[model samples]
Target: MKINRLLNNNVVVVKEGEEEIIVMGSGIAFGKRKNDIISPDKIEKVFVMKDKVEYEKFTQIIDQLPEEHIALAEEIITYAEKVLKTKLHEHVHVALTDHVSFAIERKKQGFQLKNKLLNEIRVLYSAEYEIGLWALQFINDKLEVQLPEDEAGHIALHLHTAKLNTYTMDETVSTTVLVNELIQKIESKLGVKVEEDSISYQRLMTHLNFALRRVSEGKPFDDVDHDMNELVKEKHKSAYNTAVELGHYLLESYEYVLPPSELVYLTLHIQRIQRNNGEEV
Candidate 1:
């Protein structure tokens, strides 16, 4: 491929047909100017970025970024993909690299941004959270920087966003925060703690996740069974009431009203939690 430009000695932009691809390797573009042909053997990684803004940002930021930081992000992403068994969005290379670089810089300056959603992320996105924890230790071993566990939560969020591809960072954060809030509400209303690792809790989290997605996508729950809804409401008064409280919270926070069918399923889950806790449901 022909060089379009050089971002750094180890990073270069090359053109293949009409597309611009970022190529990275040690000394890949050393002593080379624009329009130089890159040898196939020198390339270590090739990033074919489709997001225009992210591509521009990646190219613009590389000059300021340490080569090791970029390499570290790639290593973490590779590990995450391997464990998660899914390919993340290419934007992660840019986003995670920028975030980790800034975080390391801030650490040297004696400041670390606190992740408020750390607990929620640990509970809601356990797999990604585990990867994030591994990344923190990997960063420590490679860079000798002891980034706090909160950084793990931030990293997990980035990985989660990339996995979903559809949810932006803001949406992912919002969803996690909302799920945490809903769980707290459930605990408060039912007077029982939902074990984060329990099967019932996982089911509740799964239902809440899809419910939020449905609401955000404007897909109504059209399979409302009035008889079942009324029976559950009557049989499981406390759980049904807690579900109604969660519904109100969703309505107020998200402006999306939960339908009766959703309430019924949600009530069942809550009742199961209560039953698991040895409470009268």
Candidate 2:
């Protein structure tokens, strides 16, 4: 690969064929000028970014980012990919790099942004939330800056945002609100509180969050299985009844209707939470 631009001694924007990609390695760009061919042995990492906007954002931030911070963001993304089992949007690398770099700067200045949805994030995106918490420790060890729990929530939000490909802060907050309201409506109809820390509750929160996003985007769930829906209604009457009530609430308030399959899954989740032991009620 030929060097297109050098960000630093260890990092360079290189041209491979017709595409520009960021390559990182020790001494990869040292004493190298534009059009210099990089040795394969010196290259350690390459961000094969395909998003044009994401590539631009990366170019803008990378020059200002600390080498350690970039490495940390790369590690976090790799770990998140393994946990999430999905390919992340490329912007996550640049976005997370900016977030972490500025977060450290803010910490040194004694300024921290508060995440009001921390509780909801923990309950709803528990897997991502745990990854966020892990990132705090990783950041602390790698950068020696102790970021607060709020930063963890921010990281978790970034992870969630990456999965969706695009999300605004307002949309995240609105989704949280919808999930909370939907859960309350279901609980009220069922005459029992959904255990907030339970596995079932987390699963429901995750499903509802995605469902709310789909609803907001005007995406209707058309793959409803009528046979399974009738089966759930017959086998889990109370849970299905609770789901129906919640469905009505969504229709009345948000004009969002759950597909029959989603309703069946919701009923199963509700029944799981209601069960005292392995046995069904």
Candidate 3:
């Protein structure tokens, strides 16, 4: 396709059918005027817009920032999508690109922001954290700069935001806060810490992440059978009691009551994990 609009020496915007696509490659747009057909051999990546709002913001960045950072963001997002096995939010193109751009600039000027939540992010979002580390390596290779691991945590948070399918920063923070609060209440009720590194604990983390999001959005698991819930309450009395306590806490604190299905699963998870930790359940 012909170059409809050149973003930079290495990037261009092309019209394919009714949609606009951003094309990237080293020197792909160099010395090529508008409407010049891009050589197929020179095309390295083509990013089709999925969210017009996000695409608008991304194109704004493309029109303003240096091409290298835009390219870096593309590489990182592509690699992350492969490892993550899901399509990230389209805003990642602009957000991550802006982050990498400023990160490089700050690194060159001897400035690095310490990520206080680095440890929590490492344990809670290991997948995204690993992807973040990969991003650091990619940046180092392409930009010839060694970014600190704390930057990985920051990048991980960004990836986490996209993974949650939430566009706002507020949603990301809210989810994290709720997850931490739920775990704290569980540990308090059990009078023991859940093993952060254990596989069972990982399972709990995943469950709570989605659970908290649902509660925050006023959504409840509406189809839980009362009979099955009664069975669990009878069979696993101790864990069931703790789950009821947690359910009560949610109602008291968040004004959202947990459904019976959620309580049953919560009891099962708590019992399994507590038993794994050698606690009496």
lDDT of each: 0.87, 0.82, 0.83
lDDT tens digits, residue span 93-173, model 1: 889999988998999899978888787788778899999999989999998999999999999999999984468899988
lDDT head-to-head 1 vs 2, winner: 1
User: Which candidate's TM-score is highest?
Assistant: 1
Ordered list by TM-score, greatest first: 1, 3, 2
Error of 3 at 3 (Å): 2.4
**RMSD score of candidate 3 (Å):** 3.5
In TM-score terms, candidate 2 sits at 0.73
Kindly give the number of clashing pairs for every candidate: 0, 0, 0
- RMSD in angstroms between candidate 2 and the native structure over all alpha carbons: 4.5
Ranking by lDDT: 1, 3, 2
lDDT for predicted candidate 3 compared with the true structure: 0.83
lDDT: worst 10-residue window of model 2: 272-281
lDDT tens digits by residue: candidate 3, 26-50 = 9999899999999999999887877
Which one wins by TM-score: 2 or 3?
Answer: 3
- Local accuracy of candidate 2 as per-residue lDDT tens digits, 1-281: 88898988888998768888889887898899999999999987777788888887787787778878887887888899889999777878888889988898899999989887787899877788899999999989987989999888888888887884667656776889788877777777666776777777788888888877776787876465788778879988888888888888788887887777778878887888667334344
Q: List the residue pairs that clash in candidate 3.
A: none
